[model samples]
Target: MPYTTSPVLPPGTLRRSPQPVLATGDGLVLRPWRIEDAPAVHAAFQDPLMHQWHLMASGSEAEAVGWVERWLTEWEGERIAQWTVADAHSGQLLGRVALRDIVLADGLAKIGYWTTAAARGRGVAVRATATLTRWAFDAIGFHRLELLHAGANEASCRVATKAGFALEGVKRSAFHHPDGWHDMHLHARVHGE
Candidate 1:
């Protein structure tokens, strides 16, 4: 239970769930992470913008492998649902998307995403966000979804809006990165919205 005014959640509010591979009609494929993807994931993290915004960088294949292992642990612990965004036909890694901070009892989750340098400006993040948002709402019956990004991240702001999440407002100094504290923009989409 969320210990809030929200309705009591049904039984099985928290349990291990399968990370099924979801495919879109086009070429997008959302699937679980694998160790072999370490090099590619490492390459993507080499992007300066990704490292700056996320405050996470994989300098070695081992570190990237560890990152995937941690994500698998988070999934097994039922705390986060993450997927490696790839091309369905080509199977090339494009990015990653996640529904983290999952409060299943309250039917709410927050989304985060990043795209590889080659995939940016090509609608990859927007499409991935929309697909996951639809899955969260339709398949899981989640009532609300949120997207948050540093206020200075114009690209993320655009992706949030394109995914049908309205800009809620800014949270002052909500994130602390190596650079400094950053203001964050909060965007949200309700079930009926």
Candidate 2:
């Protein structure tokens, strides 16, 4: 069967350009990554959990700078929109979130996020994810958004659940981590879901 656009939009619509900031109130905001964020980003990537699930580890400030540069290029190309999740009160870097693999003509995208060790268990990832999820649906006109995490990542699975994404089952041997191929727990929320 052929795929079709949702009733809300015509067959070929591009996503809206990402805004400068997505404020989550109570002192957290999702903003564009800055060159100056390289150091903080480098440190966060050093966390043991980050390397466990994220696969790649930044070996130096230069590698972190390259990370930020890639995101800048992604934004320019409209393939991804990455944001620095930060504290509004202290401007501390909490983590990162992104809407990647956006297929605008089909009105769907994927969401990914992680939080610093200090911000873990504090709902920063959940709130940032929720904010981006709403923006992707309501403002960007996406019909569906997905969040997939390694099955071993209980913390991220919890975040996806808390952010209201319904568990859609696992994809066996779906991702390659440092350890080996791992199953991925896929979760999703459609428009109005």
Candidate 3:
């Protein structure tokens, strides 16, 4: 499909332009990334499983902090919107969910997420993905949402299916994994008009 431009936000916003903290099910909360969360984010990124599955970059504590800082700047500048997934009760960081390539005019966006190994298989990704999809369609007025996963990642594919995204077919060599280019399964959900 088509990628749309980012949304434009009003002035003087320190947090995400359209700041929203969403709670998914009972255990997970989706909110904007915070600078203080760098340590937890750094530790999560160090996990080889996360690096392999999510294709995340390796970084130090300082680098993690910088990454969050840059994300904040991008959010404020209306470049990308990101959310940090955390435990609702214990307030522990779980992972992250983001609506990237957001184009307000087209009312479309893409969903991407990953949870820490400790939080896997607990429906964290599914719940968070569903929550974000709902928020995007309802609150943000998005008309469509898309998710893509490496063909080898069955768990990610399951999350998309569970969240009501229809399998849109596979794209050959759609993603450049660390090993090489891999085919990706594309999934999508359109808001009820």
> Best by TM-score, which number?
1
- TM-score of each predicted structure versus truth: 0.92, 0.91, 0.88
Would you list the C-alpha lDDT of every candidate in the order shown? Answer: 0.86, 0.87, 0.82
- The local lDDT score (0 to 100) that residue 2 gets in candidate 3 is 64
Global Cα lDDT for candidate 3: 0.82
- Tell me the alpha-carbon RMSD of every candidate: 2.3, 2.6, 4.3
| Two-way lDDT contest, 1 vs 2, winner | 2
Better of 2 and 3 by lDDT: 2
Better of 1 and 3 by lDDT: 1
Candidate 3: list runs displaced more than 4 Å.
1-18
TM-score between model 2 and native: 0.91
Model 3, range 49-114, lDDT digits (tens) per residue? 776766667578988899889777667654467889999888788888988876665666789998
Clashing pairs in 2: none
Error in Å for residue 148 of model 2: 0.4
**Candidate 2, run of 10 with poorest lDDT:** 10-19
Tens-digit lDDT track of model 2 for 1-193: 7657444444334324444688997679999998999999999999998889897799999999999988876775656789999999899999999988876666778999988999998899999999999887887678899999999899989999999999999999999998999999999999987
Q: lDDT for model 1, on a 0 to 1 scale?
A: 0.86
* Model 3, total clashes: 0
